[model samples]
Target chain A: MNPVLGRVFPGLEGRSLRAAAVVTVLGGLVGVIGGESVVLALVLALAGSLATLSLRGRPNPLAEEYGLLPAIAALGALAALATPSLLVGLLAGVAGLGLLLWNAESARDTVRTAEPVEGLLIPGLGLAIALLTALSLPTASAAVGAAAFAVVVALALVVWALQGALTADPYAAKAL
Target chain B: MSGGSADPGPLKFRPRAVALFGAAGALAVLALATHNAVPLFLALPLLLGPAAAATGAPRVPLSFRVTWSSEGSRGEVEITGRLTPSAAGPSAGVVPTFYRPEPLIDRAPPEVRSEAEGIAFRLHWSAPYPCLVSVARPMLHWRDPLGLVERPVRVEGDALRLQRFPPELARASRAPLRRTTPLPGEVRARQLGGAGEFFAIRPLAPSDTLRQVNWRATARAGRMLANDFRVERTGDLLIVLDLRPTSLGSEIDARLASVAAAGAYGLAQSFLDQKARVGLALYTDFVESIPLASGRRQRYRLLRALQAATPGETAGPSERLAVSLRRYFPPGVTTVLFSALADDESTLVLPHMRRRGFPAFVLSPSPVPLLGQLGPRPTEDDERALRLLRLVRRRRIAEAWSEAAVVEWDDYWSLSSLASFFARPAGRRAAS
Candidate 1:
């Protein structure tokens, strides 16, 4: 397994190999719209294969911890696939954001309980955000796409911040 | 530990600076191209706002978390560490180095190796970045990076205090009492008797039945004597722990404490098996008395107190031991003192106990005798070197205790050894 691919799409290895395949196929479809589908498909296929291989023989705590992130991404992708409508895409985007928020809250609670739940959630959210961002671009104008990318980035930052802060000193004085 | 170097402060707002420079360059280019003001409009916010934010953003406080299993004499243990931006929040990029003060047996630098489980940072625009570190063994060290501006903060939490005691060796000494000694005010043969297995035989007392008389003894003595037998049950045992700071020399103080603790453990087990009441009186100069009762509950209570004991620096050796003995311990009980006997104070307490009618057994894990063979110098320049030497000496002292039946622990042994040593023989002896 190539370390680079694992780093790029952290929690999407394992059962999510199918998800990675779907993403690769979507990239190929994009290439079809622009007449370079073969090249896009090859690169995506390589990345997906590397990701799937990296997941083997490894305990995917990250996968379990952030299971909802991919689920939410899949939902968004399904919604986009169902209708190319701008409104539906926007609603799907909101749903992805909602999933991110849910994961963040779940991570915070897990830290409170001193459990390793965040291990799954962090990478799970990373994969979902990356996939959804890639999927949402077609329906949006350049400005809107940039804005959406910024929002996703901001959300990632928030998740990182929350994980750091929440786990820093999870238990209060009374709990100790 | 080396003092960490200074950090290159928060990152400069280079984007804003470039933007400002670009704006001026663009204005000049535009003027050269068409004498137009269009370039000025593009450069204003680019040069100012982001650069201002970059300069204005608060530095993220860097902190760390270190979690490991309990410490003991085990050869290997796993430790996990996490480095995160502190309460101020995540910044663009931050790397943390994990440090430990214990020995590590790995060739890799003391940095986390697996970024998958490593620290994850949120960079600008909320992108997640991960970093991993691997440690080969459990130890004590620190984590600090090249730049020290935002120093790594230590996350404090419960640390497992695993102190390995010395080994337990079979001792040559044995108890002199062959008969049970009974307490006064009880007339029943089972309740009132001397210490050990045998009771007594006397002329059939008013309450004694004819069947209670020992016919063989009566025939030999030619009298109607009743043989009364009592069960071996209650007796007193006292344990004195030496907490002098000097006693901690050469031995990892925690391990030294553990060895002393093991003696108390052995005594408690012995007393419990014999159905005798056992009491504990723990003391250092500063902490004079933590008197524990003799029973099932007291056994646990004593161990708990030993676990919490730490050597204080204030008192001299003799003064501390003397004060503890005088203030604590019940009168006339069998006393057992566990110490390294490194100082005069602790050694003198034994003779004092003897004068007071309590047979005090001194269990010293003193290293003075073994020090000559163990090393060349009294001290070393390296901190780790000194600690290792101390650990060796502590184990030597533990070995000395194992030689005496009254005490327990062999040199360089661990808590498990002490546990096993006392388990069988102590049980059998006490049951008898």
Candidate 2:
């Protein structure tokens, strides 16, 4: 196996590889939608690969030296600004934000099991994308009047109360 | 079940969590700078991940129970944890801190899997030579679902200690015993009037049996007489480990100390099996000794002492061991000194013990094998230097041999030669 590939995939098994593959497909999808330069695709691929390799506990000097992650985000923002289609910009933004979180998760001393993180992160990213897309709708934002704002505030208060009520008691120690 | 309190410290954000928050803040700032809503929307995923993880992170009480058993050199460990819905629960990724990489050997990484009740893993470890190995209580690692944070929960229990001796040392049961204590045992002693090989005739005592009466002696003397025989009793053995630093350096001394500890364990185990009272003395900056006694519990005590044996920074005078031996162990008890005999000070230890009336033996682990294994000589002149060093080592062993029986143990894997040396009668003082 190539050293680079070994570091990126680590036995070519586990959730990290699957997650990297998904990130790659999302990057490719964004590239097709934006009709941007090949540089965007290359940047996305590099970021995804770096994120995957980080899980193998190898020191990554390249990511640090070039600030590759922030650069990718900046490029995505620029691509979104340049493209004419709103859909392209939405996908680009989503991809950039998703890649940043992925890279952040990979930066650890040991390979992490994906069972716990995948279930939460995948849905969280999807929910964030959906929320962003819904909020981006001009008609929906205009139609929502003072009544919607009051409703939103009421829901927020209810969530806050629930969060407080659900907090576990620190005194209740359990043994295995 | 054993349990410990979870750390009461504030929640520690993973580096990635910090990075997530930083990325969110960076993108939000970029959105403000560019006067565009798209960049702001792009930062949502980054902000949402850590927020979700933090809100959902387990604060509910959790507990873990870890147990292990030795299957040859490998330890099979099982971990069971009680988890609330708030926690990520137990998984294969959670590992104890005691799992460390061994030098010179590329061990197979431990594989953990979810079992019916908990999780199980295998840890492969061994002492390449004879030595005592200790496993300390390890900290259990736990991570949140998003891998955004982690907590290290310490496992509470007694640490495991084991002694790995060379397989050849098991034959030490047949080792010759010259001195015996007052306790009755299998080995013959110098004293007469017991059920063993006949010695001479003596006037018949009330305790003398009809079979022990010597008719010829009785007829010649015209008086009642009985056959006397050598008594069978147990012996006292004191194993002393020389932990003083050597000229070879700390690294090599550590290797030598491991081999010596193993050798000491082998001798102690064999002697203890033969019903001999076995004690241990570790001579470092000061003499640390376990008093001589015979039983299963004494074996455990000696092993625990050996587990802590390591090479020391400074060397105590050879006479210190002799003085300690007189204070703790009985006089004329056969004392075996495990030393490399690398320096003249070590060479003098056996003689000092002998002067103090301990029948001393030196099981010197030769450092010659370690030299070859460490690496090749760095320069052409280095080879000559090593040769001169070998000559000096030989001279030291020779000096020690004059004082007591010295067995130069060059092999680390087996102790057949040492066992054979022990098998020979102790009256014949020779070197191998």
Q: Model 2 TM-score?
A: 0.73
lDDT of 2 at B124: 44
What digit string (tens of lDDT, one per residue) describes model 2 on residues B1-432?
112254423556766667667866877687567655455445656566555554443443444566665445312222222211223333433434443322212134444444546445554444455556655444555555565656655454565555566677776655445554554455544456556777887899998789889999999999999999865554677788889998889998988887788678877877677667788889997888899887789988887787667899998888888888898877877677788888777777776787887857778898887875534436767677678778987888888878888877877766777777766765234321
Off by over 4 Å in 2: A1-18, A21-36, A40-85, A93-118, A121-176, B1-11, B73-98, B101-106, B152-158, B178-232, B374-392, B426-432
How accurate locally is residue B91 in candidate 1, as Cα lDDT from 0 to 100? 28
Instruction: Give the chain A TM-score for each candidate.
Output: 0.29, 0.47
Q: Tell me the alpha-carbon RMSD of every candidate.
A: 17.6, 8.9
Model 2 chain B poorest 10 in a row by lDDT? B76-85
Interface DockQ of each model: 0.03, 0.21
Give TM per candidate.
0.38, 0.73
lDDT of candidate 1 over B1-432, digit per residue (tens) = 111222324444332134334433554354335432222222222222222223223233334444444221333323334433333333233333223322222222222332434352211110011001122222211211111012233354344333332323212112311222346222222244333345777777877766677799989999777766665444555667766666445344444555566545655655554545555665555544555354567766766776556566555544445445555655665566777656445556555555654445555553432443434454544545556666765664454434323333334343343344336666325322
Query: How high is the lDDT of residue B218 in model 2?
Result: 94
How many clashes show up in model 2?
A: 1
